[model samples]
Target: MAQALGAQTIYEIKQALHRCPVQLSRLVIHKTQDYALELVDYKVLVRLNPLCKALYLLFLQHPEGIVLKEMSLYKTELWNIYLQVCRHNDLKSAEKSVAELCNPLSNSIHEKIARIKSSFETLTDKHIAEYYIIAGARGKAKKIALPPNLIVWQ
Candidate 1:
């Protein structure tokens, strides 16, 4: 009977769906007063240094955009986040680190940004990684191009 055939087809469709290896997992950033960023997908937790974490979070906060020339302006705010994640008892010793971050002439900030990009790539493909990177065209403002919907802010 057609009813029996339809029931068989339904069972087959359920089996097919169950056999397909597809599971969706979201990327989440766990927040803490310590100011560290823990990038978590289903299987990986990417860890970053305090300075790198601070810079990455700063960009994430600003979806609009930020340029290299403007890196100096974020120094105070960057330090505030960095200080919380830094493993130092005194802020004096960490002053040099913040100084370098604020220096427009320094490439250290660029290096940190690259590390953040690579960290994501290491966990996923370039396609997924690209979503999380600070992307911008030439002569344009760079941004942490991830969609606001994809990011779970904690």
Candidate 2:
């Protein structure tokens, strides 16, 4: 099936379909050589409305707990789709569309983090340490003064 629909042909089809503003399809096919998918089998998978909605909800509920690596992977995949969209449309328009789709979720995730911070007073130290880890910091660990009511998890 893949051989019958070559990557270039698939990409061209996606470009044409994308140009039709009324079309509802979310799938975007691109040349495999253009982007690398770390996991999942496909060059690009522009999730449909339902899956995207579900993911947004999950992200809202567990923003800090979500794995950063997985989010990075998903962003990379989406960026590839943005590149494909740009091929058929103007680059600025495609970038704006992708940003419009992604920015809200990004803001929501940040808001969730802020909510978590506000809910726990003594969590400041632990949360800061976690931020360092997420930022890929290296060096000796800094001592954190935890309040008596605060609980630290190893």
- The parts of candidate 1 lying over 4 Å away from their true place are 1-25, 33-41
Q: What does candidate 2's lDDT look like per residue over 1-154, in tens digits? A: 3343343577776656544444121212223433211112212232223223223323332324345324443554555554532344466665554444446345543443334333222322333323211122223212212221232111
**Per-residue alpha-carbon lDDT of candidate 1 for residues 22-120, written as tens digits (9 for 90 to 100):** 433455767664543444555667677777877887887788988877888888888887776677777786878888877988988778888888887
Which ranges in model 2 have alpha carbons more than 4 Å from their true place? 1-74, 105-154
* lDDT score, candidate 2, position 26: 21
Whole-model lDDT, model 2: 0.34
User: In lDDT terms, how accurate is model 1?
Assistant: 0.73
lDDT of every predicted structure (CA atoms)? 0.73, 0.34
Per-prediction TM-score: 0.75, 0.22
